[model samples]
Target: MKARNRTIQLVILAVIALIGLFTIVSNLSAGPAKYPQVGDKAPDFALAGLDGATHKLSELKGKTVILNFWGTYCEPCKREMPALQRQYDKWKAQGVEYVGSNIGENAITVRGFLDQYKLTLPVWLDQDQAVRKQYGVSEYPTTFFIAPDGRIAKKQVGEMNDAFIESALAELVKK
Candidate 1:
């Protein structure tokens, strides 16, 4: 009887091990998930800014807004900050707004990075990471060009220069 009990225990253990191995293998076979596509309604989000105020995507509904998702640690993001700043300076007078959403970073760190780079654009801190997930931003630097009607005009997956920004802005900005 004891031998039969030991045999049953061993079989159960083996089955559990097999189940675990199968789960791991299945997970490994699954590839990376794809992000959201263009033409989708830009997800509404509210995040605390570096200035201690909160910013919501729904609040800025009338004007063309550029939503840039970036992190300080991303080299490409740091590289493009200057160009973005220049574009913002030139077009801000024309009622274009550029917002940089810092993903998964503390406000202090983001503030320091902005100060170091002398970036004056409004930055929203997505510390909770909910907005990042909402926007389907798996990468470091993704940009969404929002039209005056609050729909996504264009989706840029990587770094953008002043010319690229200007071109995108020109399409959305009304004359």
Candidate 2:
């Protein structure tokens, strides 16, 4: 009787181990999620701005769009804002849309940062960071240069300078 009980316990443990192994195998087989790369279609998202305006990526299809994912706490993101502003100023007249997507921040905080920087570029708040994750923004300042046709021309993963921004814009518009 004791031997039979031990045998049953061993069988139950083996069943649980098999289930765990199956789950692990299934997850491993699923592989990693794919992020948007250069030449891929930019993932579209509709997020609200500080002014209470909803900006949709698909709606800006006809214009070259610069999607900048940033956070107020990141020094590199702050450092690149002026360069972005300069580029925006240079290209705004030509219908270039620079969308600054603030990741996981409140309106007051973002508004204060913008005011402090004196940046007038259109700012969108990703309060839940859904848009940031959709864009696969692992870093603080990841900039995606989307061409007029809605294709990603370049993915700048760090702080950008005026020259790099200009070159990216030039390449984006060339499409």
Candidate 3:
């Protein structure tokens, strides 16, 4: 009886091991994730803004779009908001679109932050963080500079200076 039980247990364990191995092999066969890179078409997403509008990225095609993924809790993000607003002020009339995506924060908190900073840039609420994952954003203040033709001109991973933004904007807006 003991030998029979042992044999059954061994068979079950072997089956489990084989299943695990198969899963691993199957996962390995799947290719790596492809995120939007510079020159690739930026993925389109529609998210509600703090301004009570559902902003869609595809609709902003033919204009240079600054899609910034930020979090209210991130200090670096906070540091850059003013600079972004300044650039927006300077460039909006020239056909630049600003899409500020606040990741995983409630409207009230985001509102308070924006208010406290006196920043006028329109912020899109990424309440569920779906757009963050779509953009493969692992950090705060990841900014994508999309060209007038809807291609990604640059992907900035951290806090941006006024100078860097100005230069990128120049490249983006050049005739």
Candidate 4:
């Protein structure tokens, strides 16, 4: 009986080790990490907008893109929406594109929030959080400022104030 119990314990340990090894190998073979650093070219992703239009990061090559990841339920995201909208409105004529990505939410939910706030910032759906995971967003309101050349100029986690938003845009548009 003692030998049998020892064998069972060994078998369990071996199974756990195999699982860990498999996980490590799987991550290694999954290609480069999608978490892009500052000055690195932002990873390209395509998401559907409310109007059923596809918005792709790579397609906005010559325009400074503000890629914001947010959820409707987040209060900070709600508070900063106006500031983001203002900057987007103020700088869009100068070739600044704002891609408001709603993480893990359906269109109806996002539409309701948009209607409640009367927001005009073109929001895209990140259903299943594929884009969220790709961008390595662990916070509710993470913003990525992509330069006109497609390189990430800055990445901001947490809520941003109006001045910070303006400053980032000022730099992005000037480049």
Which has the greatest lDDT?
3
Model 2, span 27-145: residue lDDT tens:
99789877889999998899998899898989999899999999999999999999999999998887799999999898999989889989898899998999888878898899999
Go through the candidates in order and give each one's C-alpha lDDT: 0.87, 0.90, 0.92, 0.91
Best by TM-score: 3
By TM-score rank, best first, the candidates go 3, 2, 4, 1
Query: What's the TM-score of every candidate structure?
Result: 0.77, 0.81, 0.82, 0.80
Q: Rank all candidate structures by their lDDT, best first, as comma-separated numbers.
A: 3, 4, 2, 1
Query: Which stretches of model 4 miss by more than 4 angstroms?
Result: 1-34
What is the C-alpha lDDT profile of model 4 across 40-104, one tens digit per residue?
A: 99999999998899988899899999999999999999999999988888888999999999998
For candidate 3, write residues 77-126 as lDDT tens digits. Answer: 99988899999999999999999999989999988988988988888999
Task: Give the local distance difference test score of model 2.
Answer: 0.90
For all predictions, the C-alpha RMSD in Å is 9.3, 7.9, 8.6, 9.3
Name model 3 segments beyond 4 Å from true: 1-30
Between candidates 1 and 2, which one is better according to lDDT?
2
| Model 3: lDDT to the true structure | 0.92
Output the TM-score of candidate 3: 0.82
